[model samples]
Target: MKKDIDIPEVKNVHVAVVQEKHLEYKTIDWNAYIINNSDTDLETVLIVSQGKSETKITPPMRHTIAKLPARSYAKIEFLQEKVLELNNTFKVTFFEGNKMFDKTYVFRKNTINEKALQTLPLMQLRGVLVK
Candidate 1:
């Protein structure tokens, strides 16, 4: 017989975009992170970018996390050429204890103050997942 499963709340996870500087070329790089803060372990975690204009900025990048232990984070590095502007949204999906959960995070060009770009390893955006 089939059984009902509980759907995990989006709040259990966290996501962030980080900006890093290249030491050799002195250029900027962007990366995404999925942090699992809940008590359950996440399986088949997938991070995908959405929106037309957004894909142009970064060519439809996707990252997968086979398993994300609770209280840990998985990083997805953006290795493409730097673009002057970025306005995009990312969706993160994963399963916890037979329950599925997903959330999207939107980012505008000004999400991170332009001035802050001067600093290395800066967190461009950060927030808890929400439905």
Candidate 2:
């Protein structure tokens, strides 16, 4: 007799905020990304703020990921007139194998590097989802 075995699904998706500096312009840029570590692709990806207050507090930001391939990443750029506090929260939702998953990531204000403002062409903030 032959038996069938069940395999577990891979759910190793992560979200991060990357800060890059431009020496020529003497400016710093911040970008958010959704990183997929699973073997399967994540479809119908949607990322947004968790609450109304969070949305109102932060400057205008855009989420630009329609689909995230396996072992790949998608970037989200923020369009702001002024640099606000780094503390923020986001909700990430995606589908994998007919199953949907959602997670929340928080970027603390403490992670912000005040010194990075004086420096140029440097990576300032890097955040990863905990657990």
Candidate 3:
């Protein structure tokens, strides 16, 4: 009975980081997002995130999206300059139809910078995407 449940593999879902400019503050900011590229809607979407390294760990932050329509995206959280120095991890879980899917996406330490900017799929904003 333990292995009878079917857990489908997550595909076309990703966590990405992007840079934003605050026109009023005249400063740049970094933010994280979840992208759903599949053709079906995802329900009960939940994302838990944290940052950690050899000697330090940050509190886990959680976010929930009631329903993420196909080929859409949602903002997860804003990334601080200090948090980017640690390895950031996002655990994503959601349901498609009657099946469940789960996946963990991570942004390695120091990897979410301007130099890593690229054309993001679906949402055309330039950012670092975790595939």
Candidate 4:
């Protein structure tokens, strides 16, 4: 039987876009936030990309949940290329372990604006701010 899924509320804190050679890797910071956007716990992670070339830097790993406390913060870094494959569009997936949450984001090497941000929410979010 299919079981119900419990997804936590996660808010993206910051994102760093790096351009190396002809490849671009985006590092995103994610943390648990209150439903009312009040306070957050201090729990974070540093997720780096496996790399851009066909040779993956690291195998796909599971992301642990950030039990963000109010007034605290959690940092999560993610490689955009992993979720959004080359030439592909935005994508969303369920992240499990420590906490259950959904990862909604996009991978693109273009301008950052309303048009780009608009595509973010479609993945189930208000909008993802790209830098």
Candidate 5:
């Protein structure tokens, strides 16, 4: 039965889009990161992302991490300005001990911009946090 299965609730993990300057290229780039705020490490971490709109849907992008240490973060990918106009989604799953957890974070169209920048958790960077 579905109720017999244990699907743990996801917490202390987040997906964020950060705006960073490319000193070498004299340009800027928007990067996605996965943050782990829990005290335990996450193993076999997997993140699938995509951009979608009523008229168009970008191909799903898959990113994986063998293990994510506690209280740290990892960069997923870079986003172009054009992609910023589409609804971006990040589906994250990982295992802590013997339990599995998953969560989806979505950044609505036109919401990933400088005006929405804020200090991110466990990192000294300013970016938009998926709500």
Candidate 6:
């Protein structure tokens, strides 16, 4: 058997906010800070981050796969908005509680002319710490 290492497993999950600069032909790096920990088992942790819209907030248009330990970042690309185009803007709000967690990461995508790389990899997630 292989030796196991120790790391802080996430229990709760939430997006601090949605952030984007360009919403047109260009691409931008987006990150959803997932607050989580191990449920019962120390080794197994569940982190769920999905893109959807509700009465309170509008979800992301296009996003990569959900949470992954090794790859903790995602990209938001714009194809076309039938009714309402992004035009570089997004928003989030505090919604009710559920099995996952009661948290929100409001975001707006900004218009970017050219392609640019994100400066920071994983920035500190700040907001009301939902416990």
Best by TM-score: 5
Across residues 24-57, which tens digit of lDDT does each residue of candidate 1 receive?
8898765556667677789999988743353564
TM-score of 6: 0.25
**Relative to the unseen true structure, what is the Cα RMSD of model 4?**
9.6
The better candidate by TM-score, 4 or 6, is 4
For all predicted structures, in order, the TM-scores are 0.66, 0.63, 0.94, 0.31, 0.96, 0.25
Query: Poorest 10 consecutive residues of model 3 by lDDT?
Result: 2-11
Report the lDDT tens digits of candidate 6 across residue range 26-128.
6543433433332321122233233333322234343333333432423323323321213223222221122222223333332222232233324343222
Q: Tell me the tens digit of each residue's lDDT in model 4 across 80-104.
A: 4443333212222323246544343
Lowest lDDT sum, 10 consecutive residues, model 6, at 90-99
lDDT of each: 0.62, 0.58, 0.93, 0.34, 0.93, 0.31
Order the candidates by lDDT, highest first — what do you get?
Answer: 5, 3, 1, 2, 4, 6
Tell me, what's the RMSD of every candidate?
5.5, 7.8, 1.2, 9.6, 0.9, 12.3
Deviation (Å) of 105 in candidate 6 = 2.5
Error of 3 at 90 (Å): 0.2
Candidate 2 residue-wise lDDT, 36-60, digit = tens: 8778788988778422234456544
> How far in Å is the alpha carbon of 18 misplaced in model 6?
12
Candidate 4 TM-score versus the reference? 0.31
Steric clashes per prediction: 0, 0, 0, 12, 0, 22
Residues 22-89 of candidate 3 have per-residue lDDT tens digits of 78888899989999899989999999999999999999999999999999999999888999999999
The TM-score measured for candidate 2 stands at 0.63
Clashes of 6: 22
lDDT winner between 3 and 4, please give it.
3
Model 6, residue 14: C-alpha shift (Å): 8.9
TM-score of 1: 0.66
